[model samples]
Target: MEPVFRPPSEANSYLLPVTTGCSHNDCTYCAMYLAKRFRVRPEKEVLEDLAMAKATLGDVRRVFLLDGDAFVLSARKLLRILAAVRETFPGLQRVGAYINAANVAAKTDDELRDIADAGLTIGYLGLESGDPETVTRIRKGASVDEMVEAVRRAQAAGIRMSVMSLLGMGGREHSLRHARATAAALNRMQPRFAAFLTVTPVEGTVLHEELDEGRFELITPEESLRELREIVLHLELAGSIFRANHASNYLPLKGRFPGDRERLLETIDAALDGRISLKPEYLRGL
Candidate 1:
């Protein structure tokens, strides 16, 4: 793949791979950064890339700080990259990154605040499951409390936050608890958004090994939909935008629930009942 570039804050932003790989890629399910060992791009190299991006792209409204766990970059390194991003992209207004809880934990409140003050508006995380057993089973590397703390600490630092949740993370065994605990955790921080990504086991990931050995059961399409159904029903979001539009999901749904939890749940169920075939699993990123 070619070197990717984007300002610190781009929504639907392109990629700026300051790091080549994920620091903690032990999550059994993901393959996005498995092929490369983790390392930060030299600051000079990152600056040069930013310079090139500035020369080419002019319109910039959203940017997602690329790589799996950009926040894992050293606080000083992150500051420089952010400063470079701001300086290079005159049009940049929104900046976000895909962050993991552990990475976020590495920063002090002051450091996080400084980054946010530098114009990094959003930070995204994957709180895959809130249940301890489920989290351990997948080696997600953060406990429920730790996940909540990550969210709280991020929020405290003045950064708007969004997190992803895997609907069938616990599979059939602990689905309900996963949903309830996850919802409970989200309720604590109630970040700017809650994006739902269905847990689809990709080939060549630890998750597949579990699936192959029958240690884990991939939920049926109907079961996955029902889990989402139960989740949205019980969620007590203040007014978070709930999105189930990721292609891996059983249903594509999106809307704002202004404290109308029941209505949101109903919406999910209705969509499930109405769809004829949510598409073949393979065609659907199955």
Candidate 2:
């Protein structure tokens, strides 16, 4: 089988796996966790991966761990993985992985620091929304407050953070509140890097079914650009790296935030009203 996680951008230069499947896989919009039971691969297996990966690529400077949520590893187990990777590779500069809010809550501050010190310096959290109602609707598990506390705790523990906020996650019924609340969440946590992903439904998922049945109306690629506009305008992040460079983003913009924010938002607005769609405009079609 192919590796379950791929680099989301050009920044990552190595492959690693901290865990497999997603811990909070019940989100209505996701199909990633559909085919498998959620589980963290054993530490010895992961250590062997480190050895194999090093043999494949020497002088690997950065590693991005695979799959939906790597933080599911117990603090001690994660620490062991990071240490082994460093001991084996010796030239790694950074390590990163996706983390869920519940898993963030699972570890104590000291444990987070221990993992960071062992070499995992950055965390990528998918804060799909800050609206409690929206989170419940999708079963994402972490509340707005829980997300805030989680980022705060992880930072206090020395793990620098990045987050993904899904634009248009609220759909037609809740877009404004979604933007405002998501903005509020960012204002509160101010992660080191934050990104806005325009939501695109994938097949074999409840959200795809809803779109198919006309039960939920997705904002058009045009409307998604509009929603992203609102999300960015109200966003008040402090010196964070921001990107909308995912293939899913209509306009693949990337730059330092609280800096190019106005230009980025304006560009999104223009892309929304653009005569032609900014992207391929696949609506999942169920």
Candidate 3:
């Protein structure tokens, strides 16, 4: 199995593959799992992996389930997997997984709570763009409203959500709208962690084809910064930690909501005005 794709913060965590590929793999901008089919590893295989990890690493603090959208597993199966992991690794502290909104909606609130109680603590969700039009164009597979409700329910069930949004997902045409709408959605979801990454159109993705055909226009670097500023200015999150330091981002930014909001905007302004140097295009990556 391919190494689990995870956030920077999860670098030290053990990657346990619960599912292979993404359940919703039609997102136009995504190329992460295009070459693979989505499928859940059987419970026996999951437990075997956990046992192997336990034998190799005596102590494990964090475990991240992979490859993508492992939360799509049924409540019972997830619970069994969580129980096995906890049993195999007595020192386990947190179990995290990628969660798709549709999969989240499939679970009852009680099921979510049960999974959380069983040691699954956090869920990473990709909300590439919150503008309804952009979401539709990208084939994200769920409406903005559906995603909001899904995250809300998961949070209510004690699962801390780490939400991610891509800055240039809407292209030049809907940049401002995407930023504002995304801020609004984040305010409603109030995720524990919110990340911003610049869009990177991979060669085989629909987004790349659209760009090639002149159907979509990529946002300029300055416009991407402006969109970030618009989002920071409008975000009314309670305590969400914001990050824009992805390698794909032209500028790195990190701050807490409301409290460090002004500072974040200032940084963007400095970058926009040439007061601070932006990351060279050569150093940027997806």
> Over the stretch 11-93, how does candidate 1's per-residue lDDT look in tens digits?
36745667776788788887876777778878888777777776787655566766777888878888888887887777778
Segments in model 2 whose C-alpha atoms lie over 4 Å from true places: 1-3, 272-277, 282-286
lDDT of 3 by residue, 6-25 (tens): 77778899999989999888
* lDDT of candidates 1 onward, in order: 0.77, 0.78, 0.91
Q: Mark the regions of model 3 whose C-alpha exceeds 4 Å error after superposition.
A: none
Sorted by lDDT, highest first, which candidate order results?
3, 2, 1
lDDT of 1 at 203: 89
**Error in Å for residue 260 of model 1:** 4.7
| lDDT pick, better of 1 and 3 | 3
- For candidate 1, the lDDT comes to 0.77
Estimate TM-scores for all models. 0.91, 0.91, 0.98
Better of 1 and 3 by TM-score: 3
Model 3 error, position 124 (Å): 0.7
Q: Write the per-residue lDDT of candidate 2 for residues 165-250, one digit (tens) a residue.
A: 88778998888888888888988998988877777788888888888998777766666776777778887887888877776776
